[model samples]
Target chain A: MSKYLITIGLETHVQLKTNTKMFCGCSLKFGEEPNTNVCPVCLGYPGALPVMNREAVKLTVMSGLMLGCEISRLSTFDRKNYFYPDMSKDYQISQQARPLCLGGGVTIQTPAGPKRVRINHIHLEEDAAKINHYARFSGVDFNRCGTPLMEIVSEPDLSSPDEALAYVQALKQILVYAGVSDCNLEEGNLRCDVNISVRPEGQEQLGTRAEIKNMNTFKGIYAALEYEIARQLATVARGGVIVQETRRWEPDLGETQSMRSKENAHDYRYFPEPDLVPVALASEQIAAWKALLPELPSARRERMVAEYGIPEYDAGVLADAKENADFFEAAVRLCSPGLGKTVSNWFMTEVMRQLSVTGKTISECPLTPAALAELVELVDKRVINGPTAKELSAELFENGGMPGVLVAKRGLGQVSDSGALEGFVEQAIAANAKSVEDYRAGKKAAAGFLVGQVMKLSKGKADPQRVGILVAEKLARLA
Target chain B: MSHTLDVAYVAELARLELSPDEKRTFQLQLETIVNYVEKIGELDLAGIEPTLHGQALVNVFREDVVVPSLDRECVLANAPERNGFEFKLPKIVEDA
Candidate 1:
């Protein structure tokens, strides 16, 4: 029912795109042989010390600046004691008392309007090893161990599944634009944990919250929230109390099962890590990192709408991805004056379809911006008709070539010459005498069939609008 | 104020299987250590900055450079169990 309100928050972990591990000099590449990237520091061997990677710290600060967070001048790492096979030391080095960034938010556009979800903190930590399970035994890949990871914890400001999805999307766009992380959910680069609770309408106090973890895709996050919200609402409707617990989202089952209760929660004895020293950033360093922040996604979207005169919705769609927005701008720069909307339409429809089919991003598209601009120019100048341009676009999408060269090679130039069009129109009329009789007998729509025949005869090289006019003239003379 | 330490809980968190006598001895020893360290609270000095570590160093970071990683065989040599260049463990029933 609409009377009950759903609340959601997210804890997203992104693996920073760095050259080496956080505390060691091991390569941070993916899909390498198991344990190939392991080192003494990352493997947590006794007497081995850790030296913090400067690039990881710089990236964290840059990300904080982009998100409008307050970069803490003094931050330190702490040891979170736990027993897990993923970590060789049985303890994780994390930011417990103080994190790198604090108090930022992301703005998401919902159907109702735009809403801002507040973020609690973003802390820098190291990732654990990946575990692969089999029927009888398990294997551990230490390649991912000690990879620089940033955890972004947001305030419970989301209300619906759509809002949660928009929040994540917005965050990913900003991160990618700022060059912080790739935000790739497939290779486990980005992971999210959804915290959800529901309360009756007009309630000030919150209900018990359950956290759903290990969601690797945005679609799974949306579905998990939807299912959990309904389950919670039904429990409340049936006079049952919600329990505080951690749930595992079984994507195959489309349901969540309780993984751990409140009693089993680990009381991680957090203390300052002695091996690593404190990080004290100067004011000049903070200001320098802030200066490197680029124009974020939302601002770029608004500017695209205002400067290019495209519709707000179109700008929003284009600016949702960094590469898509960059491609649009590059193409628009080469377009003629007042053709921004034309370029946007081509990108949204034809270009997007091609991208989906080829499984390539806009950056990887074979057709360069100049090529697309030339095609649009050809259509505008009537050098090629609409159908010819459409056909050439598919050809260009498959094999990279100049549109003009392709048109010249294929003889797809539109025949707008009066003599050539008149000859085709006469042939069409002579072949379709019955349609001509139908038109003279007041079946006015029969002329459309004649026009179609003329196009077929011309092999779609004739200008369609000119064919219509020529057909009309020939038909009147016959009558 | 006095603090208490739950040795069983601590041992469980550390993934250690301790005997009952060892647990009792650890509880007493941890309490004594805490009591000994609590003596610093008796000082009345104010405006003292809390030291993060014993050393007075800050901003010790290495440059972003690529270095050689350990050999795969050498890295896996320290594992208690191995299976085809990977660390093998008992079947982990938990799903990711």
Candidate 2:
């Protein structure tokens, strides 16, 4: 068997979060009644003209700046002629010859180290209307038509499935941080198509590539690439030729089937759109959009590691989403500098667990950063033990309330008083006589049993460390 | 002028249902038009800038603001076929 190097490229379409349609004044909202937002301009009625939306162009420039792409000073929209029912117009107005952004790359952190995936260009276009097919007839919803969409094309710089996943994740983080798009895969706000090929080891020429389309999730993208690469490698190993085609990923079946061959490709006769004039951006305006880009994910991740002394892995997780990273920073700032790692651990473990269960984002979390800091402080001050703090965190996660007030109202405060814990310790020894005998009979591990008994008697409100010492003291009296 | 026009291919791209006679007629017409347009290459306009459009207007853009869309009945009135509030088409076996 011969080892082959896998090559992958990704083309992602992200719908920009704009108030209006790309070329019209229809509201760019999702889940509206079908065709309710349609107008003459977006519906492509005869004699209707399209005026460019300024904000959409500004957002494309912002995306270009964030991705380190060269902003094209003069860009224009071209009509891509195709026969699709999705677009009411036979032609889609898109940027082809001159796109809004050119030549950028996103650096992803692979296990081997940092790898930069080059982006060929980013173009702006209007999204096609959604088609919902039923048993016999298909319905066309024009609500999504004419929404500003940014299509980002990346070079074939990825070598493995993991790198491809990391590349999409990194790009998504930048898009979110720049506030260019919502980038929600489930909402069809973001869609990815991957082009993959494999060649024999040390081969200079690339193999024939297959493009996997309509992958809406990162996991699906990873799985489709893995399955396709294996299929290609096996075909080549057996002397079978790999055909250049497009495949649709059936996620449930965990395999890709041929969708269309290269010969059936559409010839989109592109011409400059005459309805809209060329956009000429000033240098000052470009500089202003560049300055408007927020601190990107990579910079935030590096700073989190340097400033908070968190592990690189933890920083990556914390800074993956801008909202979660902002929440961590806000909570850390409310606490002492030494508690950075402690605060990060709470977010990574408890907060993330709750979020996964509820399907809510960190921004939608009920617990505020200040309240989380207060809960951590209560644990530090011995007002509550570790177990009690976790319980309060669950409570806080459910209901938005102050951690201190919840502890006080529920009487969950830790009982560190020696008198109170000593009584519980004596009661535990009396109750677990067999365990006491085991302790005296050279079973040193029996002390842990007695301490657990004391915790049970105190209903977990007793400080665990103090209970351990008190249990030992009471046991020593028997000796 | 040496290039031949494939009118059938163009008709297919434009989704036009043309007969064989129409395709042949269009082929001849497109070739004539292409030959005529190719004459512009003979001009000695080395320093002249190519005009993108006839109008001198540039940078015409509308502010990003929401305007009222047409009512559902009015918008759907022009559709050749409609089902309830949606435009009804034949079952599309293909996905974009």
Candidate 3:
């Protein structure tokens, strides 16, 4: 609808959840005391040689396999030259020419259908230290230095802000499901850099782009894109040309500001890192890693829908988090074979609601899957009414207990016997003569009041459905 | 023989502030070293793959395990300035 076409590309950096740093033996921990994880290798001392971590390499290769990337047989590290206090090292050891993975794409669901966003490459690198800015000076914490990070560079395949959000969400889901990274945005486990440009409609040549750096949240990325896109469009509308430079997203200000101009752009003269040797991966090792990969998030969603006969929406909600999907599967396995939809219904309504109200994740849920299965089975067998079951649901979610045992201990089972229902109906009819006369006078709605009275007399354990049928039969016989 | 070295540009990249006299002196010295290194171009190395290191080593890695790091006080002993537990530097104007 506009006079220009916009293109967006993202460079996402995910910190791998490894036990140790990438090039050193320092433990990789978050929120630890600053500088406690410092070592000679990570501190970039004069004569410290960096040794690569095997687990870091394996995790990177596993991620590539999950994303359908081409595993590079021979990958090498290069030194990206820069001068910054955050990196203590004058250069960062990263992959420039030969990276670990190449040419894979993530399929993001769009309004039209599924769209694939092409990936340029995924390279392994080390994270820099944390810097806290003060009024007069800056403080640096080297605890985060040398932590393994993967930079996933995407091609300019996304055209809108919504597509970008979906792309990032999809990628994060896959990474989390693969167990490569925690993908916690709040903890700075995953960060994003967005490069966006705008060109006139029907223009073949791409316009100059502005790069927004170091966005840590999805909402922040989407907001930055909307602002930057409009800013470029306004610049072009007034016959101004777009300049290629780096910018920073000011989430508080809701705009992107120029961080540096193009004249001061970094010229990272990268060359082979002599400290670390090139990684030559055998074909068999790549195959072995591929075999070890678990079922990724996308595949699990489809399988859950097909195997469980649940709606696609339910499958998506359950698969949004790995722990949620795992809990759903565990509960379904404990229940009857064909009651997946029933279990999913409870999850969609009572289980999720209880979780939200209690502020707990599926992993932190106190109720066991076995208990949930038993509760569902009780309801299916007419052992408990809906109201009584719902009341017990709250109790079970708060403090877990066996549903069958709790039913017996509290006498909460529904009374569905024909004789017992007839007795309760007889008492209600004898007590409510006015209601019976009104029912005979063509006031059919009064039967509901009589059913309520029967429920109260039975102390809320009587099955309301069967009582309704019994009450109608008695009223008809009297008429 | 067709190689051209831009001394100023290379110095800028290395963040070195070189004097004109030093630049002129180093230019010849670097050219001499490069010319000597270029002698290998004459050899028939068509079948050989490019090598990045002197030793024939690849996939040399250590197991991922935590080893005790240096104590914080020892780590910060060499800091020019420290604020409590962190290394402090002059206020930076540019974002890293």
Candidate 4:
């Protein structure tokens, strides 16, 4: 492995976000009863015609646009022949000679930083039904049949697991943000097949690559690559050339095992699907739709960082989740971008924490962006201290309505009156003689405990930074 | 192009069980398919927009949901084994 360069390629199958199965009117819900959400076209009953699903196509084109692919003015579906129990039609309707989208790239952030992976093409196809195995006999569920699938294939540009992972993550992120697919791997909405081969450190020619299939998770992809690297290294040490074959990623074993010799497309006898006509997208139509795509997450992240002056890290965290980005934008427009960062901190740390505990999405939170904006405004204007504001934000997330109303209802308004704060500070000092002594002795950090005592005495309504400064000045006089 | 893709080789890679007679039949059929594909080669497609889907179709939809489903029963419904829903088959090893 040290002397050889591992070359990797990926084939990602993303299920489109559509209401019905690809060629049928059956609901695309994962469960309804085995074979329940299926009809003639999906079941491959004789003479049944497949009316092209426009939503699937639109989603595909949008995905293509997001990936920077050139849409093919003329694209068509073909029939891939096979005989599997799960294949109700004994063939898969797919694109072979021509596909919907071609030549795109994804830039991913790796330990080595951002690297772009070149995509060869993206094609549309139908998923096969599940082959249910039994001890006595085997049955099939056609519910998954004709489920819309878009296969995104990358060029042999990825050189390592890190690059491959970054590529997959970036591509998956784009697809998700495009609202093209949910990309839930366990549900098999997004599955990946990896092709790996090793070339001697300076060799110009490529090595024969093996295909690893059935990897259903990002973790599975990482483990599969690690195993392939080790396995290939051992083969090289033994002076044995690695064979090109298809392998199954045994996620539990964290290794890849040989499945079958990898085959090329000729094996499936790909031919233009005779039952369906070639789909020609009008230039004007695609042009109009292309103009409708929203600014992608990456661009939005950059905008938040550049225009809003929010920290890049915070912006990235907010933009990473679509809903969070929406909330951040809505809240940021109401207050200063600096306030967005602070509010983002509360949202990420406290709001998300509570959401995790209560199992709620940001959309499900009772705290509206307008209310969050209001709370942030109060804090930015020094109407409340950070702690009190955080408390109010949490209450707002748990409860409902405007922050100002709720703050009053909870009696948690911050106390900034210098005289009252001075009295509280005096009481706290009298009670904490040791801490006061420590503060006078130049133990600067001891002020925190004293400040905490004062805030506790004030019901946490005192502005913390203000209290800190007041306590430090008082301790200096005592010194 | 030095990278000649032999039809038979690709078929083997694809795990096809084509018979000898079928290979000859496919040889002709496949050649025709490739020839028709050459039409794409004819156009000076430089900067021409590609259509992802035909414009005539629309509104393909599925309800947003996760309906409760079978775990092993659906998997083993027609399986040819009883070893707790696993499909039992004749053991074949390729070490020979």
Candidate 5:
């Protein structure tokens, strides 16, 4: 393919983490008995008035704070007039002109290093129900209706499918870490639509953009863009011009097909909803939210690198997730800050290994921060050598335990005191007489025999390095 | 003067079967709504901020956790017919 810079923007619709749906008191849950939780307001029965939910607003503000976005002091809902069986009102009340959040970004780590994807805005609205269409008749269930959805629009900043996937992953990490949203794509909590346009290399102007929608997974987004890019390039090579349109990604075919033309059918009749008043937030209110803003991923990653002296790569991994960063911070506090490098290493290796195997987040991890800190303490205090400590750690981390208590109960104390270690070394030298003779006879591999004997005498608690050093020193006397 | 939608096509798209009298009456009402919007557009909005929604955008999402959905019986109870849980319908196309 000829050199072309692809510009991709994303519109992500996430169901808010509210206990109740917007405009109605229906329970904000995924799996419930069909149409059981719906009420008159959500069902669009005449004479029902929608009372807005306040918890939804607070959660949106929390999300905005996490993303470093400016909260709109004044906001109002508008009726987006449309007709569908899934929507009882035949119109959706959504944010149109001014949104709840504006001007925020998340930094996604890509192969090209850190890239900031600026979010244009995140707006709140109600979700439509699912319509099961049949050959002649159709069915609608209001189970999904009234569910609060936050539509986040990102600026046209990303250049590739990989970058888009990275951006989504980064956003999910922050949202989940913030406890703002669960961001589950499989459960339809978080869904993505990509706006992509490709321009000739070094061209100042952008090409016509195609909106590819309903790519439910990260891989689907990347694959859809890859397919669309190739298709556009092939069309241009054949002297065909690319027209702007809305496309749907077909995962089964690995292709993108145009759903509708962009020059057509896009005028949504947007008007303010009369049922609610315009929401206003004072400067003091916004300031209070600003103060509540957490250490974002970028800031936390930088601090982790500088304060903890962790390597930049490990810092990025830790900061990629909110809970992971929190876990790292907790470990640093509970253990010693000097153990930062070791903590990072253990988390990146053993902790990540466990999280992946059990499919759990650091927040949902069965192992606690204090428990892990104790394991690291075992190593530092020389109560258990590195290899044996790892074995104990795996056991403790997998099956939960207090390391200090476990070590005391199991009698697996390390022989770090030179006197105690020498006793074990002396026993090894007495028992491995042939090995000591082998060492004096110039068979250097004989020292390994003495080290093993020392380990057996110490009950696997003898430090390997110290064992080797003491074995070499004691073997020298035999010479 | 303002542009009011014909609504006939939109009605068709919605699979509605409206009579001539309803269409004519709706046209007049639609024109009234369009003219009202035209008046709003003509207002001096240079300093007035446009309000998107009454609620601030909340970044709410469910945990990507999946739970058991409604059983097929409950799901299809509202359906006219079903091939087990699936809603069955008439043949979309007739044989050539």
Candidate 6:
């Protein structure tokens, strides 16, 4: 590594999944016909007033609580004045000074252990319209305008690109666990802007920083930071100072290019939005929202390991998605005690493999958790042997049904009774006379072949272990 | 007293082309408005918080239910140029 310390901060914007726009009643749907969701308020028509959506505020506060943020008692909206076609109103409504949350941090796992990346604040804002560029002219679609967005600002505490990735992933997990936003980067539900600065190993003050804007993918963010950091280090080494400017990440070119200098930046004249009133939250209300906070992914992972007796790796996989974790818990609750690991094993191997093949999530699976529990119980109780249960599980996964009922319906129960299995064992001994002679002549492996014959003769219903014991008894009596 | 504010810069921000005469006229007018607003600083209001809005209400919110949007034709009727269903503008080449 070079003798330079790189500090990075992130400004992540997440779109809330609300029914309507932030300040209007237009539905927030993606991939619809252009300009179809426009209204007077969203279109920025004159004399049209905006009404604050209560759901948006609740979601933002819920997200803040999940991240351990201190909820603000009083928050207000401000208009950031700019002349961009993305926003037809010429000023976008955002929070400048007093945001909805303050002083939260996400704890990310690092090589040194878990480190908490500090958050400056999270503010509510309205998304701009979609500008589609063409060869001749641009097309403006106002459908996405005024959608509720939250800007999560982090402190420049990240030391490496990996740390930044971990912080973002952890933050996304918390938000997804809280049901705040979809956090789908491809759908533009979540986006990030990175601020990076580099200084010599022992410098006191920070070097001039450069910002890369609108990075939507984790790979793109990592690559952009790597490229930008190297570029800055090279400049410093060549006796050239880094310039503070805004840059764009070109994924096709695999580099970041300067967009504008600090001098060319727009001075957003912020003023309190006159249309919407200030939101003064009550202490009781804040307490209620906090109570509604769901168990975070990290906490749930720890609990899964302690309560379910699963390995850390297994717990992490289960807790990655709330739906999967819920399915696991539900299945375990219905199962017999001390079978949590068994249930997780089934999930990690067969269930996951089936889900991937079918391209369906646990929530969308036809085989319910109760059914999975029953299947595992059947195997545990020896009602069905391992291979029989495997076959039955595949069937159950395709067309969901109770394992016991299906076994009974299909006459697939294991033949474990000695009296019931003795006939098959005798038949195997008589049919495999050569193997029996070999067994008598000290070929101990002949017993396995005899058991396989018994299994085939019994149509795979006989438990191989029971057949093995019966075959040994008959063979010893014959000897 | 001479005006300290640059009227030209303000005009540029507002996207208005102002002649020198118009600039001088607006400069003096803006100064009067600023001076009038500055008189509020004379009051003994060290403990008072700055007002966020003219109204005294707070926590005014609307439910999150979505209503019908305006018809697409009506929504695009006011556009100076229309590209099928969207509003068309002059070609904007992004800065490299």
In terms of docking quality, how is candidate 1 classified? medium
- What candidate 5 gets wrong by more than 4 Å, as runs, is A1-3, A109-114, A132-139, A201-205, A260-264, A416-423, A430-434, B1-96
Candidate that beats the other on DockQ, 1 or 5, i.e. the better one: 1
CA lDDT scores, all candidates in order: 0.89, 0.89, 0.90, 0.79, 0.78, 0.90
TM of each candidate vs. truth? 0.90, 0.88, 0.96, 0.81, 0.84, 0.94
Residue A317, model 1: Cα distance from true site in angstroms = 2.4
After superposing candidate 4 on the true structure, give the runs of residues whose Cα lies further than 4 Å from its correct spot: A110-113, A260-266, A336-338, A355-360, A429-450, A466-479, B1-96
Report how closely model 5 matches the true complex, as a DockQ value.
Answer: 0.14
lDDT of 6 at A405: 96
**For all the predictions, what are the DockQ values?**
0.63, 0.62, 0.73, 0.09, 0.14, 0.70
> Candidate 1 on B32-93: residue-level lDDT in tens?
99999988889975999789987999999998777898888888777899878889999976
Chain A TM-score of model 1 comes to 0.91
Best by DockQ: 3
What is the Å distance of residue A133 in model 5 from its true position? 5.7
Per-residue lDDT tens digits of candidate 1, residues A243-307? Answer: 88888999999998888443434578899999999999999999988888889988998999998
Candidate 6 stretches greater than 4 Å from native: A260-262, A429-450, A471-479, B1-4
Question: For candidate 2, lDDT tens digit of each residue in B1-96?
Answer: 367678887776666899999988988889999999889888888999777666777789898899999999988887789878889998877633
* Candidate 1: C-alpha RMSD after superposition: 3.0
Please report, as a residue range, the 10-residue window in candidate 1 chain A with the lowest summed lDDT. A259-268
Error of 3 at A319 (Å): 1.9
Ranking by lDDT: 3, 6, 2, 1, 4, 5
Rate residue A8 of model 6 by lDDT. Answer: 98
Worst 10 residues of 4 chain A by lDDT: A259-268
Q: For candidate 3, lDDT tens digit of each residue in A1-479?
A: 45889999999999998999999999987899889999999999989999999999999999999888999999999999888888887889999989999989999989999999999999999999988899999899999999999999999999999999999999998998889999999999999999999998999998999899867789999999999999999999988988888899988999888985434347788989998888989999999888888788878889999999999999988988888888888889888788999989988799999988988987786888888888889998899988898888888898888899999998899999989988999999999999999989999989999999999888999999999999999888899
